[model samples]
Target: MEKNPAVAFNQPNHLPVCDWLNRAIDQGLNERTAPLARALMRVQEQLTWRYGYERMRPGLARKYAYAELLGSNGPVISENLILSVVLFAPKHIP
Candidate 1:
């Protein structure tokens, strides 16, 4: 079986940040949403770099793990927007 690139490198599996954002905008998002999308991408990049695919503590209340990347207290403050990554178990059924 072929190994996943992100797993082999101990990195998160996500599209290249800037490229993804540009594509999203090109697809349908209005020009005004560009700034917000850029901010969201920055947050996503931060979380991906920080956690990658590390295991979470056992017996946690939530089946997934996540970190707030943007919000009132996050690195990127946003009054009207928030971005986070909810990491599910590998090959999760649901």
Candidate 2:
């Protein structure tokens, strides 16, 4: 398998949760959805950091990395929301 050029293994690809949230808000993200969006971003950052891009395979059918932030166990303290981040391999078809 060839390395994915989009994945930056040596550098951080995602911004910090607070920075992301602020940017989202500045970009016109609905105020009502800010909390949920923040939580989702946090989960995404955690997953990406946990599984570096180098560890992810690049293909259509290969296994992907995922992380689930459920209820009180995650950044969101709500029992109703479940935020999940699934990092799929970038499949470039040429």
Q: Residue 21 lDDT in model 1?
A: 35
Off by over 4 Å in 1: 1-62, 91-94
- Candidate 1, pairs of clashing residues: none
lDDT of 2 at 37: 58
On TM-score, the leading prediction is 1
What's model 1's TM-score?
0.32
lDDT of 2 at 18: 29
Cα error of candidate 1 at position 27, Å: 23
In candidate 1 the C-alpha lDDT for residue 51 amounts to 39
Candidate 2 per-residue C-alpha lDDT over 1-94 given as tens digits, one digit per residue, 9 for 90 to 100? 2232122222233422223333544443467766765665544444332343654444422434434444334433345565555544334422
Worst 10 residues of 1 by lDDT: 1-10
Model 2 misses residue 51 by how many Å? 11
